[model samples]
Target: MRIAMIMNGFPEISEKFLINQVSGLLEAGIDLDIYAAVRPSGSMRHFAAERYGMYDRTRYTRAARSTKTRVLDAPRLILSNFWSNPVAATRALSTKRYATAARNLKTLYFLEAFGKERYDIVHCHFGPNGLTGSFLKDSGIAKALIVTFHGSDINSYPSRHGTNVFRYLYERADLITANTSFTKGKLVANGCPEGKIAILPVGLRMEEYEFPKERVSRDEATLLTVGRLVEKKGHRYLMDALPSLRTRFSALRWRIIGDGPFMNVLRDHAKELGVSEIVSFEGTKNDQDVAAAYMSSTVFVLPSVTATDGDMEGQGLVIQEAQASRLPVVSTLHNGIPDGLLDGRSGILVPEKDSPALADAIGRLLSDKDLRETYGNAGRDFVAETYDIPLLTKRTVDLYESCITS
Candidate 1:
């Protein structure tokens, strides 16, 4: 089957799960193409994108243009692709339906890249992209449409645009996939049809990770957190716990991987809290760099919290990744995180924004070698059984077949 995937950006360090899905599909010999809105803006890169030759298969829209620029280029864009698919070219200009994007000729530019090709399925990663994929279905370019809602798209985006923002996509999409059950509930609350949605948590390439044979000593343990340095990630709360943690464990260290808009703020906060000497900002690292950090670290702590705008963690993919790497985790009980890890089994869960509780959980793991080893082993087993990429990929294909045949 021919498949086309739509996303907002390509090769993002934060969206490794999407790359894993694409790579798994290609490895299974599926004919797939990617259509992205923009290229990578961050310095960090993923190996799978290069290994799978993703760039060669992706088609990116041109950079954003001013109203004057788009008006000037509209005639050339229309004349260039008018003969190839005149119906699509004309349908793309219906301002009544397409709104501002149509008026600005953004749809025409996308049509120029989409060409006249047809696909069996067009899968979009987030809600807004599903609205874009709705255009493909409306223009008769795709046989079916599937949209997957992660976290922010269901909470933060809708919070800004209002809950009914996805009503148009709900009517047009053939199926909707939620990364977690919590996200599914949000979709239902926002008026998505109950029967149209499915829960499909992101999976990991388990074989890529190697569980450490030896545990780090309790006297000199390193705490690690891997994710975008954003407000919702609660990096500051982790820093808040560090000063108290230092009083207990002198040789303790915290290594924060990944970068974002909040990096400078986090660095400044660390200094202000007098934990700069114990904290190290590792910036944005690639997959290999991240895997190595997982191996060297003693505990993985993702202190996720509901941001001011009501955004929360969906699946906490890195929590599973840390478990897959055999590192014991201490994370918050926020949104879908509880569904991702086994509380008190593979990881420990604490309340959001409670620095004292965060410190206690990390201290418990660091002080006890036997408990750490047990949790680490259990975590590896849990992720391998529940989140293997090959198994999830087959299930994804099954969903596609159902959509195509129905």
Candidate 2:
């Protein structure tokens, strides 16, 4: 299958799931051309991205602050490097309209990218990009469209872009996949055709993780969470849960593994709650760093909750990732988290924003070694059975095959 993946950027820290999908697809005898609406802006690149020579295949749209900058940069970039990067140069030609050059130049970039390629499917990674997919098909790009809604696309995007933002995408796209049933529900609520949407869990790259032979103990008990420090990640509530947990497990250490806008707010809250020394702000660690943290940590928790502005987690991939590394998880029953876990069998699910419940769950896991081991082993088995990338990717491929035949 020939596929064009429309994405926000390459090598993004948060979008490793997409990278895993791409790598899996390639391994399954599918050919892909990665089309980034913007360039890879992050300093960290996934090991798979580097190994597969993806940088050589990636074509980026001109990302600029102003329309004048975009218009100027597009031609200059294409003209100067047409011989070296013929694909991008041909896609971003001088034939686009003045209005397009001023506003929505990325549309022109997208048009040109798919314009030159004959693809079996134009798969968009999020709902907003699915809007672009619809535009591409309407322009007579001979391919079916498939979109995957992971999280914020349904939670934050719809609310920000208006409820009818994806009306065209729903009507035109051949198929859609949701990361969780919660996200699928949100799409159906917003007028999507229910039959077209499939629930596809974003899975872990099993090779990259180590399934511990048995529960390993750390010298000093540590509780860890990995995600951008955002409102929905419920880091503040984790901070609130800490004071209580600290009293019981005096040597307990907490590590937060990503950075975002709420850094100052979370730092201040940690200090205000008098747990700064015990809590380490290990900002923006890479995948290898995370894999190591998973092996070392005593327990993993992602106390996710819905944000004030209606934003929520669709599927917390980190929950599964933590489980794969054999760490007992303590997370909330927020959104699609419960669906991702076997709950009482694999991990504990507390009510959202319930600091006492979260603290208590952590305490229980810390105090009972056998219980922690049981949950850890069960969690790993659950992920290995249900969330393997190859199995999940095959399901995605079946969706693509259905899109082609239907």
Candidate 3:
């Protein structure tokens, strides 16, 4: 079967879900094509395409002449299209409310680009872009349309709109997949048909992230967190927990991997907390470097929270990657993290923004060797059983078949 995976951007360093899914489908002998509205910029452009075998299948279109131009013109277009072609702009206005006006201006850009591609199933990630795919399907461009709700799209965008674009997408999609039951529940609550949503956890390659044989035991216990250094990641809470935590475990070292808008703010907070010496911002690391960081650390902690602007952690993919490397994890019971971490079984889950609880969980893991090993082993087993790439790909293919045949 020919499958087209639609995304806002292809080969994005941040959204590895799209990359991993495409790679899995290709490895599974499925004829796959990746369609991105915009390609990567600068040095990242080349790596993004090559990393996912998207060099050939990927298609890029000129959305806007410049970022400034796109920003200024998007809303004007949305208001213009709101009256004439409401169906075309419904998904854009509803799914990406902030960018609805701007995206509405670029509706023709997407319509033309998607019109040129032919596929059996158009499987799109997130809601805004999925809305575009839905529009195409409705326009009779594809046989069937499938959309995957990846966290923020459902939790923040749709929930805030109260059955605007999201409800429309849910009602029109042939199938809807979510990364966690938490997200699926949100969709069901938003008036989406319960029978239509499926929970499909994102998968990672076990071979690529094998447990290191000679794991390092640090004299100063090291704690690691990997992700974009954004507000949703709850880096500030982690830093806040550190002052009290350092009083107990004096030699604790915190290593933050990944970079984002909040990096400077987090660094400043660490300095103000007087624990800057213990904190090391390693910035963003490649997959190999990330895996190595996981192998070297005592525990992986992601104090994720729902951001003020409604940004949230869909499912923490890093927890799975850390677990795959046989490392114990500590994260908050926020969004879809519990589904990925399995609470006490695979990793410890604490309430969001609770530094005391976060500190307590980290301290417990740091002190107990047997508990850490047990959790680490359980996590690895969990990933193998539920998140193996082959298993996930098969399930996705089955979903695609069901969508097309129905």
TM-score: which candidate is best? 1
Candidate 1 lDDT, 342-385, residue by residue in tens: 99999999999999999999999999989988998899999998
Which order, best to worst by lDDT? 1, 2, 3
**Candidate 3 — which residues are off by over 4 angstroms?**
45-52, 65-68, 71-103, 159-162, 215-220
Worst 10 residues of 2 by lDDT: 93-102
Enumerate residue pairs that collide in model 2: none
The residue ranges of model 2 lying beyond 4 angstroms of the native Cα positions read 65-68, 71-103, 211-220
Give the Å error, residue 76, model 3.
16
Residue 194 of candidate 2: its Cα lDDT? 99
Residue 228 lDDT in model 2? 89
Q: Give TM per candidate.
A: 0.93, 0.90, 0.89
Q: What's the best-to-worst order under TM-score?
A: 1, 2, 3
| Cα-based RMSD of candidate 2 | 4.2
The lDDT of each candidate is: 0.86, 0.81, 0.78
| TM-score attained by model 3 | 0.89
